[model samples]
Target: MANSNDSWFQTTAAREIHLEQLKQAERFNGRAAMLGIVIGIITEGLTGAGIAHQIGLGPLVDGYAACRTQFLPFCF
Candidate 1:
């Protein structure tokens, strides 16, 4: 009876450790999301500049305004 109880305890502990590892992986992704936001800001500036340079600021702003009215993400 004692050995069987010990085995049960060990399995429960292992299960908890696995759960914590999964939680840690999700938090790690949240940290990576911060980096992604920084990258997105840089890309947004570059994209706006590229559009204005190639087309014109008026058209670039118009396109962004249209997207803002129509889409969820709004071009970026």
Candidate 2:
């Protein structure tokens, strides 16, 4: 059987390591998100289209609305 003090120390050390890793991951994710937002804003300004339009969702949404209102036979 392991000593109770040794077991407690090992658990505490592992927890500290995981906490550090979590902090580093959060920092990286935040930086990446900010970069993506900046890029999206620049693209929108250059093209005069929103993020959704840039990704081609505008057409799909319009088609869906037309189909619902006019009962089109085929809508894609």
Best by lDDT: 2
Error of 1 at 38 (Å): 2.7
lDDT of 2 by residue, 1-76 (tens): 5699899999999999999999999999999999988998999999898877777776556688557666566776
Model 1 agreement with the true structure over 2-74: per-residue lDDT tens digits: 9999999999999999999999999999999988777766766877544334434544465775575764356
- lDDT measured at residue 27 in model 1 versus the true structure, 0 to 100: 96
Cα-based TM-score, every candidate: 0.55, 0.69
lDDT of each: 0.73, 0.85
Please identify model 2 stretches exceeding 4 Å from their true place.
Answer: 60-76
What's the true lDDT of residue 75 in model 1? 67
- Report the error of model 1 at residue 61, Å: 16
Cα RMSD (Å) per model?
7.3, 5.1
